[model samples]
Target: MSASSTRPSYAAVLRMPYATRTFTAALAARLSYGMVSLAVMLAVSRATDSYTAAGVVVALFGAASVFLSPLRAALVDRHGPRRALLPMASLYAGLLGALAAVSWRPGAPVPVLAVVAVAAGACTPPIGATMRAVWGELITDRRLLQRAYSLDGVAEELLFVSGPLLVGLMTGFAPPAAAVAVSALLVGLGTTAFVASPAVKGVAVHVARAGARTRLGRGLVQPVVVAAGVGLSLGAVDLLVLAFAEQRHHGENAVAWVLAALSAGSAVGGLLNGAVDWRMSARLRLPLLAVGLALALGVAGLAPGLVTLSAAVAVAGLFVAPALTTSYLLADESAPPGGRVRAGTWVNTAVNAGSSAGAAAVGLLVGRLPLAVCFAASGAVALVAALVSWHGEASPDVRTGEAAELVR
Candidate 1:
């Protein structure tokens, strides 16, 4: 491949004939992934007047998705995206609608809401993982894949940032149920178009026996574990930033600015990472980025003032997307033949599970311990992830042709 073809720009990635429709639908579906839990929490709290109830509902939703994502991906791998996605999306939307109706009632039972939340989460189409798998299948150039993943990560960040704001706006103007209702609509529309898209339709399904035979190999699990550590560090960093700002008597505006700095750094870093042509293997890059993230976060924890803290956050943020991108690349390479979708889902599950754990642990300790200690803990978690990645072996070598045949 020529340099231009190998190191494609983000614009070039989008210019691919199938790119626009697939990405747009994927984005629509993805925005709901970020929005639903928060919207449900807010809406439930409003109806029941209990933050505790809201927490339980949200937790159920997250826990269900985390556990069920791999199964959903496996179905997609076996049946193709359209067959898997359409039914899943319909069920997910119906569940969300049911939850919205329940939440709107004045005396909605928490237990009933919890069950609905689980159902909604369990049915969430593994759209993000499926999209990545689609890209992997379509774009064979490794360098181009790097750019595509980077772009995906950056777009995800934007979605997360916007999702909450959208929820807050809708809730403020109308009722909390409006937010959940809107999310349901988005999921329905996005998944419909996504499955209908030509690129997604062209994806080949792999028929594998349903059993332990389908599990991710050890090679794929290691990078996923590393990705989890990154997620843990992220969760801690989020809470720590808020606590640190509050301790400094800085207002919400200050907190926003500091958080924005972190996001800005990640966005810029992802774009730059994609533009480069790296000779390093994903196996090697994963640990290096983890270590870099740990060191930067550790220093950030010890910073003396807001300016210093902001700078450290930006530096630490620089490693975030690169580490995540490396994790995806490693998963793609390490996945067993015919198991790419499940491999990506496992990575997603690990990251989300780790983040939830980190946030809960930090939330408990934030009031009792020093804020700097929590930051140090985040770094420590990341360091442990790096160690795990370093000690782990790469996937057994499989010929490119053989792997493609397996998928076909």
Candidate 2:
């Protein structure tokens, strides 16, 4: 296909056989992720009446997830999605149930709750990586694959936007435990459907060579690290935005609106990015977008009011999805043969770790420094990501119907 004619419309991508069903099921599974941490925090805090205990529990869960997600993805890469994801789903659901039960119990020890949270995080299914791998299997055309990844990015932004809203509504009308229970239900149903989807079942399984190493080596490591820095900036931005709203005495609703604006910009940018056929390689595009993100965020740090901050945030967010899409593409192109899912998982893990780090660091500084300083710190982190990605090895050009050979 010619370059101009190669970009597939969103509807065209969705209309592929089994595409809609697989995407919907994967979205359902992922939606729970947006709520699980917050739900756990609320439930634990309600039961213990201590934010410190709640924070510790949440931190343990995040730490477990950061360490375990890549291993789960490696399992999926080795055993195939159906064989790997279904069992993990069951374990995760059971653990979530255990967590809910513990939270509901009177006088449950904080240590016990923390242990359950860690186990629950460790068991969380590798749905995100598996779904991306499935897309790689389903779409062989490079342009179509790009569009699919872009669509996935947009869907992810939507999940973050709606997931928190769903939790808030559930907790508002019912007990905090209700939110946790609902999250478990959603994860159970969604993961089951995802594993059973025709797209997943139809994808070919890749078995690694016996005695092969599993960890990311040279080519794949840089992009994953860059992705982590991007994630750190993202997490810092989130905390800063919330702090900004609070400092201004804007209501909680205002915080939600500001976040929504950011999501909306990302979604729109992803759509536009996919609709065009860019000549630039993923290696170049990735850093360029990251630079844009850094600059926009830096400007956002200077905003004097809610409206100005929202505008700056929206502008910065416009680059978020595109940069992420490019990073995923770069990671995929650089991954070893039969290791795509593993590589994707590592990227996810790094991002999560960076976010956790950003949140922890900024939380400490928020009380002492100006909120705008937090934003500036986030921008600085993003600038670091941009520089790192720019200096990384050049990615092989993606060609229509051509399988990308693993780059050394």
Candidate 3:
């Protein structure tokens, strides 16, 4: 039977050694991150009596994290995830708890809340970076690494979708503060458990910084460019979702559905991208990205109802995670022996920045223009990004000496 025709069962996939333990660690870690995703927002907003102020706090947190990610990732590279995760996780939980407690108090100062947010953001646990570093350590084959990342992409989508949904429900039934507590506890417990996993503990981060002497720093350029393109596309799409929801006269719930649809699609796409064993050159792969994104964005314009819109969004999203996972894998291959985590961090940072810009611009345009216009414009932006990527030359492979691929 053809390998494509005779795919392994989920049970069979689960039986792979790295699949079981490493995936468990990833799940636990992601679940922890997901659990708190919205709880923190809810808590801050309640405590401050102003969602705007709370958003500022959250933004500050993200900003701090973006700045600190490289440093923390470097730590992960130098001293295994086990050594790096716990302390960072502890700081994250403690600050979150502090923010909750301070926000609850009647007389807590806004400035204090801002500081807490900064602290929280700064200590946001470079989970993606740490995980990517682990992936480089465990999964050796490039194809297998892609699959592993695809699985991770699924976990991430599920986390964002389910975490906020559950938190919203919890806050509605009980209280937002209670939800925050729950998230904090989960973050602490899950992070500790994942860090203690055998895979994470066994990792040996290169303490020395010798890798920077050669073309180590230069290694980041290609991946950063690719990541930026992907991020901008995603960001624009995210803004389009909000705009589309508002245009449809749908309630806030529409936003949730739209996001969930895109994320769900991306998750499925990651899996399919991972399973494919045949390698496609960058030249071929990059050009296809524009087509994938355009198709997805085009679907957004056809949003007759929530159901149809979601299906379209999902279809469009199918390209994001897999494309990103491939870029990340390529980044790993090009990274200096000791710079894998840092390389991953750079990718994350680039994507985050792109998303931020896309969301801002789309939000602005949607206010002044029609929903269809917004979607089309976003799609055009994504298509342009893909076109740019097509023009860039691929770099040489840097994995020749590595005995195994890094994964966790």
lDDT scores in order: 0.82, 0.79, 0.69
- lDDT at 147, model 1: 90
The predictions' CA RMSDs to the true structure, in order, are: 3.3, 3.5, 4.6
Off by over 4 Å in 2: 1-7, 207-217, 394-408
Model 1: lDDT of residue 98: 90
For candidate 3, write residues 67-90 as lDDT tens digits. 788788777666666766788888
Alpha-carbon TM-score of each model against the true structure: 0.92, 0.91, 0.86
Positional deviation of residue 7's Cα in model 3 after best superposition, in angstroms: 9.5
lDDT of 1 by residue, 1-408 (tens): 122464477877777668878999999999997788789998899888899999988998999999899889888877788888899999999999999988986678889999999999999999998888877766777788889899998898778878988998887788787789889989999999998988887774432333224546556756787889989998888788889988888887787788888888888888888888889767777888889989999899899999999999999989888888878877877665357788888888888998999998899989898877788889889999888767664324322222222222
Q: On a 0 to 1 TM-score scale, where does candidate 1 land against the true structure?
A: 0.92
The digit string of per-residue lDDT tens for model 2 on 210-321 reads 1034444455655676778778888888788888888889988888778888888889888888888899877667778878888888899899999999999999889888
How far off is residue 291 in model 3, in Å? 4.0
Clashes of each: 0, 0, 14
